[model samples]
Target: MLRRWISTLLLGLAAAALAGCSSTRLVDGQVESFSTLTALPAPATYRIERLPSQQTPAFEPIAALAERALARVGLQRDDAAPRLLVQIGVQASSVPRHGPSAPYAFYGPPWAFGGWYGRPPGVFGGWYGPPPWAFGGWGMGGPTPLYRRAVSLVLRDAQTQAVVYETSAVHENVWVSDPAVYGVLFDAALNGFPAPPHGRRQLRLPLPPPAP
Candidate 1:
């Protein structure tokens, strides 16, 4: 009878874990942001800018996600007559689920840009990968891979063209479809925009279901 009770308890625990994993997944994004402005200018109007490499139609979805994040932070997109020019950059890759390293595909280019999170010069298409931590593992330690995603937002003065606010966020998960979680990652990056915290921080948020 004791053995049977033990078996039932183990089965119940397993089932609960499965349900939790199948439900909304939690995303832990590492966020680092910097800014010079204490508050946005009057009207808080801006336009989205992209690099030459990010001008493709394939990048539109990612850009749209960033725009949504900006709006959430009380910024408006005004291309006709704007006060700020917010540039967006993103990076993603797939790695071993157990945090092992192999030849992985990296998005973006190797070119360097000033005011990034200081992750070498390769700061395009991909998140500036400096943190060596991965959480919320999937596949139950099986052969399924993990996905690493990073996003960077650069807010500049529209008239002077000088960078005023810079921020980025990175997250790792088993979900390969980025659209499902990119929105939240952007939210983490711009958590306290205009006057964000000084050091890196960890953010935990629930991932919404994929769009129907």
Candidate 2:
């Protein structure tokens, strides 16, 4: 009986490995989008509006990823004659195997990516950049810990300065690397584009191919 059980477990592991080799991992998140713009502005151009925290060069990589997402969604980047103002935010904090997490814990409820709750002004505004905790060995050690991560984008009319669209995407996972999954997060955030569905929904997109 013991021998049979061992063989069965080995076969199951082998089958899973084979499946992974040919399959792409999915980056899944909960997305919520709201849009007041009935129609996109003519020319459909936009520019990135960096927050105070996003002014540094450290944020370039995220901006690049966001640009790709924008392009995919049919929005063009034109700083000179932009019709839209775009702002993007990414934040993550470590989550223990057990206990309350800080980023979204203290409040009534935790907020996830692609969505936002009506929290105080400083909560999301203050900590929208890189996390203070190091992510050095999150995946290296046994029983990798997970992170509660979120991404959001705010779009405003350039001329009127009124927010016309807002979308956010939040996720939780063991992967601590941001750049690797950012494009997908942004894509998920902007899933419905100019006019998304009314309420929150889940999205799963193919993760980028593994680094060579």
Candidate 3:
């Protein structure tokens, strides 16, 4: 019985650890510019611009990744006279979540002689005995903070100054740092490009394998 209880506790801890590591990436957005257009527009050239606050060296690599995604969708980098301008922005935040509650509560009688398990016969209850499983609240703890990373991409007609397309992707995890997260975000942001699903939709994309 003791060994079985220990095994069950270990399994619960393992399952909780796996759950903490698992993350979900949510991709959803609206396309304000695709309504008037009949077919996906092929711009001659496009230029990527970072948000005023995001103009920093750290964002350079991220911008390059966004550019690559655009290129895949038939847009070439151009400094001057580009038909479309791409604006990329990134936002990250920490969300606090309450940890799992204790699994078992101890309440029972006090032990006396003859290995008495429960409380004695009395009006008020005796001391509560610990659960059969020695390690009942092993993993339960304080609030855990989770990190969320989001990326937004917007495309505008250079001449008309009208918003053509836009999309955003958000990911939640215990710790969000992998560069592949942004890559996947951009991919999901531009999934349908000029045309996307009308209503909000959930997108699940597999993350790249960890480097050896």
Q: Write the per-residue lDDT of candidate 3 for residues 80-196, one digit (tens) a residue.
A: 868887888655444344554423222221110111233232212221222112233233443334445567777788889788776777766544444666667777777766567
| Per-residue lDDT over 24-45 for candidate 1, one digit per residue giving the tens place of the 0 to 100 score | 7778999988888898678799
Residue-wise lDDT of candidate 2 within 1-212, one digit each (tens)? Answer: 99999999778867766776567778789999999976666889999998776765556767888999999988999999999999888765544444334343321122222122343322322223223222333332333345566778999899999999999887777553445566788899998778889679999888787567
> What lDDT does the true structure give each of the candidates?
0.71, 0.70, 0.57
Error of 3 at 9 (Å): 5.5
| Deviation in Å, model 3, residue 7 alpha carbon | 6.2
Collision pairs in model 3: 107-128, 108-127, 108-128, 109-119
- Candidate 1 weakest lDDT stretch, 10 residues: 127-136
lDDT of 2 at 157: 90
For model 2, the run of ten residues with the poorest summed lDDT: 106-115
Estimate the TM-score of every prediction: 0.72, 0.72, 0.63
TM-score of candidate 1 against the unseen true structure: 0.72
List clash counts for every candidate, in order.
5, 5, 4
Q: Listing every candidate in turn, what is its Cα RMSD in Å to the true structure after a full C-alpha superposition?
A: 8.1, 8.7, 17.7
Top-down lDDT ranking: 1, 2, 3
In model 2, the runs with Cα more than 4 Å from the true position are 1-15, 99-143
